[model samples]
Target chain A: MINEKDTRLSKAFITVSFIALFLGATAGLLQTLVRGGVIELPAGIGYYQLLTAHGVLLALIFTTYFIMGFLYAGISKTLGTLYEVPLKTGWLGFWMMTFGTGLATVFILLNKATVLYTFYAPLQASPWFYIALVHVIVGSWMCAFSMWRQYYIWKQITKKKLSPLFSFMAVMTMAMWFIATLGVAAAVIFQFIPWSFGWVEKIDILISRTLFWYFGHPLVYFWLLPAYMCWYVVIPKIIGGKIFSDALARLSFVLFLLFSIPVGFHHQLLEPGISHSWKFFQVVLTFMVIIPSLMTAFSMFAVFETTGRRKGAKGLLGWLKVLPWSDVRFFAPMVGMLIFIPAGAGGIINASHQLNQVVHNTLWVTGHFHLTVASSVTLTFFGISYWLIPYLSGRTLTKKMHKLGIIQTVMWAVGMFLMSGAMHLVGLFGAPRRTAYTTYSDHPQAAEWIPYQAVMAVGGTILFLAILLVLYIAYYLAFRAPKGETEFPIGEVEAAAVQTPIILENWKLWVGISAMLILIAYTLPFWHMIEHAPPGSQGYKFW
Target chain B: MPQLETNKPKKLKKAEKEQDLKGTLLSVMLLGLFIILSWGAVYALYLSR
Candidate 1:
């Protein structure tokens, strides 16, 4: 059924990944230009609708594509077998998702459902919009299944234990993905479809957001883990060092799994409908999250230390000098590390139960997420593409492209630093997020923030250009390649041999997941408390 | 497989990190102290203010 003439599954995934980044950049730039009033399209012509398209296309879809592409590319190197699942099935999935994205984009453009990314309950979009969303999530499920089937085949061939660190993390993340998307899927099918079509009287806002955040919170790590996976695996290889502590990375994944879901209650902390004690409990547990986060930081920095020693660099800060600066893969992760600082600071600030009052739903919260989610994670994905695409395609990414990638990476990092930081300041000064427009009446001088908006627009423009370059390079390597089999090291740093996870399949872990669900369900309650702040960003919408 | 490497027993006892994040070690101790102090400050200033 197969020939050497058949197209590489990696090629299809890379193509999708290319398009995803391109669309993501295009949508991102469009939103930024709109925000700055630099390029005005007619106001109230379904602007919220455009925002929804941008959110789903760039944030969720792009991330999904890149991670799936990266996974498909590494099949043999990761599995230690030449075995592969049917690339045709994956191609089938590719078209299904691609077409779904097109349908959803059209609906968004028509302003059929401008529910914003959160798409809070009671505020409904059209039935088409809900259906389009179902198609997209379902398409992602198909992609996940395709990867799992490949893993199954690889295991069948190897029969070795499934303990390769990167592979384990990939499957763990997929495992997380299948579980995490349930909340969003549940909301779409049960609440959104019926509610949007006028089938249900009205769905509850608070409870829906709770379930949404159940998916949403873990979804951050879902966006994030692949990037971290690249960090753990790729960075060490690029720098010529083994992983500093492989077990710590594993522990971090497990801890992330445990914490990311239960901590959604922290998001509901200020909501009055939730019990005081439960909110307090989540706040405490929320702080526990930084353990794995910091553990990762330490683990990787230790790798850098090891790499630096290999490079003959000296002193506590010596690694700074010898790290492959021009190699976009190496420096992008380094820059991503720097971006994490204030982002982490913002996260800790927001996760604080009492402190959240000052910044909740404000520009500050948006600022924090953009830094962590958009900058740190997205940059790392781009960084991975920079390293992997050429290797997978058996083409050499030239010095100039890598050089240009460094410039683009810096642009993104610096741009985010300026943009997210400025947004935080604006948020503290009472600027609300998610509004299509802002009006100043009582405080005429509220116009001072215009400069910051302008600065953000400039930053976003630079990053947009950077994203375009990344896509172009990715396109060339995947499609235009005059190629042979390229041997890519899927970073053989895990000295520990592969062990198939008996623990992964355990009934106890399943119970822990259920208990996690139960714990989150018990904690999610902020919908009814409209006395202090309006349910749907009420306090900040101006007169 | 993990047991193969971890045979060189952990010098730091589990008791240190075993509790709900309390007591001893450079990173953990400092991080814990930072957490407790920050929580105390937030409750006092922002919540009670």
Candidate 2:
């Protein structure tokens, strides 16, 4: 009965997202022994392969595809357009992505692309990984185009200023994504793969890692933005209040697009050859990134607080009881907020200059992102699924299944924290990230943490089961609902609210300004390749 | 006090919306630039030292 094209696009993205998460979670389970010292690698399985797979699974594929879908929904609602490009092209993009994903995975299994997910240079991978990756980039680019075209088409039709909520975030993430991928794709197509295939003479390692993660860190946000978008717009609208401020939401999205990509240098804090000014500038930016995230926390809480007060909850912490925890829509945001605490707090410290030395490349890095991502991004996706499934299929989730899903989410959140806390403690003591096992016979430092890593593995198992429960609930909602007429209105405000129109800025100036930032940030390091020749170092060319 | 009475709170004003947009864009972009420069600075400093 649901004829809306955009809603269907959102659902399609959700389904694909679930698929991607499954692969990611499955990887986590396989590598629960990742930190185990005694477990040796198979002759074919390399350490970098595992690292790349985990990074790509959690960071790139799941997040981008998920956000792409969320953008579809946000555009339709904000602009009130029922455009069909997203629908027709969305599935085409999906098949391409899936094909690309399969090829990438096969490359991993075949022991082909082991440069780590970002595919840093000197380390090499099979050509197919690069080939399939191009497929993915192209498909994603098409999807980005789909989003861009829809918004432009809507602008022509509505002429009303669109709220920033989902549309702004999606557009910015996609743009950054396009920017970040260029560096990696250039490395892959021109340098690494070609070198491996004997076409290229050599490849630049530093330049590749630099650009890959520029997109890499924010890539997680691309996934997270959709979830955040849903959280910002939907949670408020559903929880019996208007979004505290849609403009703030839009600003955050645009801010994320502009600021998030440049901050990738934070990942290279421990690396050599980058300048002090660059790191100093990035550390400052790292702190600044927290502001938007913190703003989101406050605005979301404001919306939740508004809902809580309406329920007549009084006093500090009184609103805790007021939330309809059983309602999937309500269940996720509240619980999801609870999980964001450790992750967000930990991220702030991890981003700091002094603290980077303390926990760099340690178990805490693993713990921090696991919570930030699994909690914020995953739960948001789950909440959207709850909203999307019943709306699209016209069937309500059984109360029992719904309740179970909530229980499972809580378990995953709480369990991940406990598991990760132990890892953080060990990480502070120098347990490195992305290693085969801490218990190498040669290293004495790792012995103390073997038991701790084992415990963390136990946590992964628990989370795996919990994630399965979530997937099942989603599946049931999508496929198992009883036949009936069910309609949950999207874009409905409890009461009428005034709609605002967009004010066009000097587009050329803004674009030029953004371009200037990129050129200024990147030019020196790029120029350094030739200008400040490190004596006795050989010049490597990608092309 | 000419307040429009409704169950929902008053809608966000256009100017207010613009302010938040500007602030958010300013804050987020500045932060991103900061983070990107972090590694490059550290590397450069480590060398200088």
Candidate 3:
């Protein structure tokens, strides 16, 4: 059982996360309805306002708070009373993040900051928006520091022993996030904030964009690694299998730390200010980052096969049938992995310089990210919530609720398939994303995208219903269920011939390499942008 | 308590484990192949456009 203090901390973070999820999802439904031409947007609330709110609340608030809460619970459970993470510091971080979210939400609601989540300057937001975002980042950094401190103390106490896999994964996730936020931090602090305050007359759009993408790509990993943590540490145990290899799991996280941050240039491939050589260099790094994901796929399948064989299943692919598919905890994350197979493949297409030309700035990009962040990451979080809410609230997840969970995931998969699939098809036919209304009715050339948009609207309605089901389940688990403690399922590794290498656990060495890589990838590009700086443009508000 | 014919079953289990490992490796290879083919198809479509 978790101590009272730790439980309270986790609960606070998770509660706020759910609040963010509800608000963000509401905005999502409104945007979809308006875009589909099914309903007109209410006056005084622009489409960009809804868009900004959806991105901030879901991408920034929901994911960050949920991750913070999950890591805290994971660390507490794995380390036990042996390590004391300062509860006071954690509470401080929570308040800061909450206050910051409130500040940002005000601006979004007022339509004072309709600069989308990318917030590319020349299209400026209120100064308060940038300041509010900095608070969110700084708040997250404090929480990360607290977790890192606990790890440090544990390491000091147990000199040579490798940290528990869950704790290790949690630390790696936070460390990657802390590093990834540096680019955004620089952009906000140096350029955007100053210009927004009228302290600077104009801002360099290219430089700001370059900085944002630097954070943008790794930001996806920041969302992904926690889901991966659950996949690596929890899913195997739920499925009645042991981890395939402990060493491989650690190696994968290490690989992510080394490769995830420096490859953001792939997002800027079409931009003119950044040169081809630097972009090519980042493209190579981008492909290299795919190795860890491939490693995860192999390890997961191996675990399934071994476990299925142990249960007396025979023949190739027969293992698939023997594994547990009914348990919501197991079913949700496994389905997430299945969706990611296609999503990851789509990501490869997005990263490829030649192929990206066909899909850039189109609904295809929207479709790709929806498959990733919306389907894969969001579904995994939904899965985590099934157990986590019950565990935190000391409640039993009843049988009825388990059935609800199953319906939620399956319906979500079907809905997302329809919506994202239609999006990809229509995108290829030249439908633009982020547009409130397409003049497809007037223009014959754009008419091909209309039917697909209708399909997307229908799919989105189904998805919105699925979200409601999830919220109901979460509410039932948290407030209505019978009180009981749930176990943290940390999978044990099956016996292997080889031992985990000591080098994989060397945090200092790995951090050094990650820093060196970022420096190599970013230094020259930033220098070029600064030295040969283009004429800056004044901020404008079209809305 | 008598230890009655445990060795034979132990040997069989080990053999099965080995077979499963090989199968797992094969499955990984197949998945990689599938991803590559999917990418190729998508890129080809893009080229046609």
- Of the two candidates 1 and 2, the one with more favorable DockQ, higher being better, is 1
For model 2, the superposed segments whose C-alpha errors exceed 4 Å read A1-12, A34-51, A74-86, A442-444, A485-512, A533-543, B1-49
lDDT of each: 0.68, 0.67, 0.87
lDDT at position B2, candidate 3? 29
Candidate 1's C-alpha runs over 4 A off are A1-7, A37-39, A43-45, A80-89, A479-487, A494-543, B1-49
Provide the lDDT at A259 for model 2: 67
Weakest ten-residue segment in model 3 chain B by summed lDDT: B1-10
lDDT of 2: 0.67
Local accuracy of candidate 1 as per-residue lDDT tens digits, A365-398: 8788888878888788777777577666666666
For candidate 2, give the docking quality class from DockQ. Answer: incorrect
Between candidates 1 and 2, the one scoring higher on lDDT is 1
Give RMSD to native, each candidate. Answer: 6.3, 6.4, 2.4
Ranked candidates, highest DockQ first: 3, 1, 2
Once fitted onto the true fold, the runs of candidate 3 whose alpha carbons sit more than 4 angstroms away are: A81-85, B1-16
Error of 3 at A527 (Å): 1.0
Best by DockQ: 3
lDDT (Cα, tens digit) per residue for candidate 2, span A1-543: 445666676687677777878887877776776654335667666655667776777666777667666666556655555456755676677678778888988877666666567665665567788788877887887787777776677667767455344565566667667766666667667665667676755666676677676666777676567667677767766666667765567656656655666677788887877886787787786676677787786666656555666677666455556766677676775677666765666776677765577778888788778777777777777777776677666678677867877888788776676677777777766788777764567567767888888888778778888889888887888888775554442333323233432532223443455556666666776677446534321223221
lDDT of 3 by residue, A1-543 (tens): 888789889989999999999999899888887777788887788888999999999988999999988889988888764245456678778988888899999999988999888888899889999999999998988898888888888788778468889999988988899898988999999999999999999999988888898899989999999999998889889988888888999999999999999998899999887899999999999999999999998888988888888898888878889988889998888888888888998899889876888778888888888888888888888889999999989998888988999999999999899889998888877788887867756898676677788788888888889999999999999999989877778898887524788888888899999999999999999899989998999999988
Categorize the docking of model 3: medium
